[model samples]
Target: MRTDHMLSMIDDFNGAGFEQVDLMAPIQFDVSVRYLKEDPWERVRQISRRLPNSKVRALIRSRNLAAFDFLPHDVIDAWVDRLVANGVKVIGAFDGLNDIDNISRALVRAKEHGVETFGAVSFCESPVHTDELFVAKAQELIEKADVDAIMLKDAGGLLTPDRIRTLVPALKSVMGDRVLEVHTHSLTGLAPLVCLEAVELGADAIHLSVAPLSSGNGQPSTQSVVRDLRALGYVVNVDDERVDAISNRIREIAEEEGKPLGEPVEYNGLHYMHQTPGGMLSNFKSQLETAGLSDRYDELLHEVARVRKELAYPIMITPFAQFVGTQAVMNVMAGERYKVVPNEIKKYVLGYYGTLLAEIEPELREKIIANGASDIRLEPSEPAPMLPSLQERYPDEDLDTWLLRAQFAGSQVDEMKKTVAEGGNADEIPQPYFGLIKALYEKSEDGQQHLKFGDLAISLDKSK
Candidate 1:
């Protein structure tokens, strides 16, 4: 999203009586800064200042924070402190592996900083992922972190109404007074019903997004869900008029940008098997078409299922998803499994990321070790502290800059700085009148315009 659109969404959320907003951590750091050359921290500061009645929530990717690898202790501490400094009031920390040990420290740090913490259980569907397992994980998060809430994060959208019926009650039973919030995608088309079922089963909260951004792999629509809740005799406290207006604005923005609007999808049982996200699935199709193997899409998916199970069922989320998907593609392309193992796969099998849900087969593990990168030790060890060395290397940079530098690759941050210095980012129109004026200025022969809106007047003279 454009920076202006992001700020406007926050304003709309506050106006619509929404109390919390999620800033996708990975997307902000990677896509916004690395890809779009925009400053995410500045955006956070702006949002924090603007929201008087809302909480600024941020997602923390376990020990990785916003990066792919497990960062050092000093880095994690600085990350939490910086988030609090920039107005993030709520932090939801989760490891893609659902490893509580990986996320516990970050959650504890956020709690110490007096920010609301949600210790998240990365939800998925597998023989190992049961109601009992989820309950145990939630209990573990509470015991270890003392988080303000527990989030059942179904990033795969695999939860069904039947599953929620048992899972919600199981989690709430051990949650004591703490809130149990449900955050599921609509990828399976069962999320709306699952959300209702969760609330009926004693879940305290449900994460939702407005229309145009809701449904079709995203969260359930706020407008529809709120209406359904009220119709079911729940006293939903929100401004319906404001929510409708926000929805309308989002739809208009989608139309203006030519972006695809979220829509309902039919339930696909195969999705339960592969569990690849909708966006990633599209990329897979495109990639296959490019490789002239489009006909083998089914084969690739089956290979994904096989690879996931072989690798002990790493939750089909990022880094893991990319790892498994890339290996699967290679396996298919090379016509041999394990003939070519990516270093990430090698690291994963070696327990470098963290504890796997289940152990990889002994023979397969040995094969992976043989074919993978030689630099990775046979036995994984804790990451060494790097803050001192990083600071020594760049003595002039602050902690914020240090954090970004530590995460991103060579010259990415420098390029982002260059783009900002060159004013390559989207221009801020501020108001509908300003948008009209900008349009008028764009059409002017000499790039000059003057406009008046009631008591407000503006003049543009780009020629000068």
Candidate 2:
């Protein structure tokens, strides 16, 4: 198959580049991502050879790059070497924390092979479980890696338009010439909006869903962005005729596989934030429908806009609909009434997909399905600068001193993590650790109950 990236043909879009850009149809860059149009290798080869001007990119997301399983690092080396030898430069990026190392290694190898490698970090809030460690690491990569570009992927459509505007510029400032692409999930009802905002800020590429393989099974459609960008007079190079054909084929594939065509394009007016928290958004979307807000979607949106602007925020995001999008959305979200626990890394796993930890590990699944979870809360309207309950519990016990205790207990806390996963009574675990969880619980709110590693059903004082 052909490997050269097709680039010469600007085709009909070559007429005149407009000063005002609409990212819905990014005239700035071409549509690419093998995950979407998995044309057979032969077809891909033909397309590669014929349409060298039409750049083809392979998404190293979950599909191409599975879990931390061993990928042929050397195979990728040779594959990329061959592709570049044949004139196709590779656009690859890291999505999960699990794959970052491998992809980063691949980028290094691709560069040595004389292949131009553009890389992007698939953005999400998960890695913050490491408490800004990943963000720092991302900055490090940009500073040292010499990657051709950085792509910000919104896999579940969690990014908001407000966020896109902020993140695009922030990333551009850091990566400069290397900031290559912005791929979004139409999931949040803001994908197109975000794309528009992104293009407005001078992003190099904006990825779109090519109709057929979009919006079923946890993904958002790129069609909305395409339609909107085109309306805004952006000259996107999409072959609209292929939209229906590809979309229909995907539908047939789902039916044959006995799965629902998960997310459908709807102007139901609920923010795509509904889909951010797994099944939570689907249910909320239904609730909004039941509220008979279908016709008054615009009004409901206005109400939500007002609520978002007016509501008191928490330290972390409560498991709510409004806090959708990538990690960049955290600053605004943490503004709500969610009290961020002192143990930021230990406490924040609300949106975590323990799916794999649950799968291939039944004991872990049973623990998760059983213990239940915690909620994030915010501050009070009290007059005084109230010391938090923890501070009040042991007066003169400095925050640093308390943090030192948590650090000491951190290793033992792994035991509590096991109890939640493998089931261990508090008594079976060490006694001193219980003292810590007991203290942690006393100072926290009702939603901040379970210390899982300590005991899920344990009452505020560590008693079940």
Mark the regions of model 2 whose C-alpha exceeds 4 Å error after superposition. Answer: 1-46, 61-64, 72-76, 82-88, 98-100, 126-138, 216-224, 230-464
lDDT of 2 by residue, 235-328 (tens): 7766554554445555644443345664555443344322243354354445557755445434334444333322211111222233322221
Q: Which residue runs of candidate 1 sit more than 4 Å off their true CA positions?
A: 426-464
1-464 per-residue lDDT for model 1 (tens digits): 76677666666677777778787576677886777787778778888888878888998887775576778888888889999999999998888888899889888988999989998888888889888888999999999999889999999999999888888888889999999999999998999999988888889989998887899989999988999999899998889887887888887677656689999888989999999887788888998999999999999999999999999998888778888998998899889998999988998988878888897889999999999988878887778887788899999878877888878879988788777777654343344554576579889998888887554577889978
Question: Candidate 2: deviation at residue 251, Å?
Answer: 8.7
How close is every model to the real structure, measured as TM-score? Answer: 0.92, 0.44
Among all candidates shown, the one with the greatest lDDT: 1
The stretch of ten residues in a row with the least summed lDDT in candidate 2 is 21-30
- Compared with the true structure, all predictions reach lDDT values of 0.85, 0.42
